[model samples]
Structures are given as C-alpha cells and as structure tokens.
Target: MLPNVTVNPAAEKFMRRMVRFSGHGDGAGFRLTVSAGGCSGYSAEFTVEGAPLAGDEVLAVGDLKVFLPAESRLMLDGVTIDFSDTPTASGLTFFNPNAGACGCSSSSGTSAQPPGVAKVDISSIRRN
Candidate 1:
C-alpha cells in the first residue's frame, strides 16, 4: 500500500520546479529515495526521471508526480515533507510524529536533531 505521506506547499513547489527543469519532457517526475540513517534517523536523495523505476510507486500530488521506492514509501508513512530555504541550511526536511529522539550525539555531546525531525540536504539536483 502507498504510505500516507504529506507534502507541504514548500516541498510541492520545489518538486514542481524540479520536474519542470528536468529536461525529461512531459511525463517526467521527481524520484525520491529515502533511507534510515543520519542523526535524525533519515537520509534522502532525489532526482528527475521520466517514469517510475521497478518497484517504485508514483505518488500523485495534483499534477505533480513523485516516484517513491518501497523503502521510501514505508519510511514516509504518516510523515510530513517540507522544504526549507534559510541562510544556514536549505533542503527538504521530514517530520515524523511517531519518531523518537535519536540517541546519537555530535562532538559537542548534544544531539544533532531535536526529536522527530530529519533534515535532508539536497544541495544540488543531479541529472540522471
């Protein structure tokens, strides 16, 4: 089953731009791959693709199409995806209410993430 993922306005806008400039033509969509790792328990990478790959499910957000792999579908269940463009960091941020605080710490001995928030840095969109 497809996960109940929520894409906030910022994220949707970002995705739309990616698909528009992907140079893949009309049917192109944004492909997102997420995994369990990082201090906040999530890491992600995205690219533009003409269609969904094997085992990938296409998530339709209005006219936008998001190709999500199986692992990403599972991980994004009940999660909210948002885009952040601040002076310090600019990327997609995932917020999972069911997630707990990560036990990992940085050199300062403090957690890198607060709790239930995972930030994925998409410094640039790589063409595939």
Candidate 2:
C-alpha cells in the first residue's frame, strides 16, 4: 500500500526541479529512500532517475513523480516532507507526528531540532 505522505510546497518544488533537470526525458522522477537514524529518527538519500527501480513504487504529487522503495513507503507514512535553505543548513526535512522524542544528549530539552523532526542535510546526502 502507498504511504500517506505530505509534500510541502518547498519539497514539491525541489523534487520537480530535480526531475526536470535530470536530463532523463519524460519519465524521470525523484527517487527518495529514507530510514530510521540518528537523533531525529530519519536519514534520507535522493536522486533523479529515469524511472522507478525494481521494487520501487511511484507516488504522484501533482504532475511530479516520486519513486519510493518499500522502506521509504513505510517510513513516510503520515509524514510531512519539507525543504529549508538557510545559512546554517539546507535540505529536505521530515516531520513525523508519530515519532518519539530523541534520546540524544543534544535533545536534553534545549535542542535546535524539535522532537519528531529530522533534518537531512543536502551536504550529508550522497546523490546516487
């Protein structure tokens, strides 16, 4: 089954741009793979591909297509995807309302990241 994922305007725009500039023709799409990781509870990597890979499912966001593997589909359920660009960090961020509070030391009350939100820095993601 498809996950109930929400793509905010910024993320949608980013994905659209990725596919548009992929130079892979009309079927190109943004492939996103996410998993549980670190204090924020999520780690992600993305790339523009000509088509969905084996075992990947296509998720339609307006006219744009997002290719999600099985693990990503499970992780993204009821999650909101957003993009942020700032002096400190810039990239896709995931907000899962059902996520639990992080146990990391930085999350001991005065954390930069709020509970249940994972910031996937573009610099940290390997584009493949």
Candidate 3:
C-alpha cells in the first residue's frame, strides 16, 4: 500500500478527459511507474498499456482509465492527476504525497512523483 495523495478538482476533471480522449480500444489505459532520477532520486512515470499486470489498480473516471503498476502502486497509491493551462499548452500534472521530505521540484515547481517507479519513457522523451 502506498501513501495516499489528495486529488485536486482540476486534476480529476483533466484525468477523466484524457482517459476518455486517449482513443485506445485496448482495455489498458495509463500505467503509473516510478523510476530513478529527479533532484530527490526517484520520480513517477505514466504510460499507456494494453493490459495491466497483477496487483495493478484500475481507476476509472468518466470513461477515462488510469492504471497503476503493481510495484509502482506501492509508491503512488493515492496520488491525483491534475490539468493546467497557463500561457503554455494544457498538460497533466501529478500531485504526489510521497515526494521527498523537502519536496520534489519541477521546472515550474508544480508537479511531483514518488520514489522508485521506473519512469522509463518519460525521462528519455523529456530532457530535464
């Protein structure tokens, strides 16, 4: 069991929309993982999958789907996903409760992830 994080209204609505809009016919939706890196050491990872492994949690919101990998779930059991649109384009933001004691830092100091969830693709795709 992982620590639970509070979900903001904006994040809940955005997550529901993203899952509904993903257009993936496959049963799987989003896979949340944790990986090494970040100033604190570990971060969370999110991905789309066709299926979820045992121990994974399937969360649904308004036809939207989000999956938490078994191992990753330990670190992000109760986190919330939020959406924000500033002068910049709209994007997903994570509000993780298991961040470092001091607090995880994003480029904008808005999003955060927990320790050890194997953030495979996200880190490679985006250079921090």
Q: Candidate order by TM-score, highest to lowest?
A: 1, 2, 3
| Residue 117, model 1: Cα distance from true site in angstroms | 1.0
Off by over 4 Å in 2: 107-111, 124-128
TM-score of each: 0.92, 0.91, 0.54
Q: Write the per-residue lDDT of candidate 3 for residues 1-128, one digit (tens) a residue.
A: 43364446776665545445556555746665654456544466555566666777776654545666656556555555555566534455555555544444443454433442222222322211
lDDT of every predicted structure (CA atoms)? 0.87, 0.87, 0.52
Stretches of model 1 off by over 4 angstroms after superposition: 107-112
Worst 10 residues of 3 by lDDT: 119-128
Clashes of each: 0, 0, 8
lDDT of residue 29 for candidate 2: 90
Q: Candidate 2 residues 1-128, lDDT tens each?
A: 78999999999998898788778899999999998787888888898888899999999999899999999999999999999888867889899898877766766444367778988877664455
Q: Tell how far residue 33 is off in model 3, in angstroms.
A: 2.0
Q: Which of the two candidates, 2 or 3, achieves a greater lDDT against the reference? A: 2
For model 1, residues 38-105, the per-residue Cα lDDT tens digits are 77778889999998899999999999999999999999999999998877778888999989877765
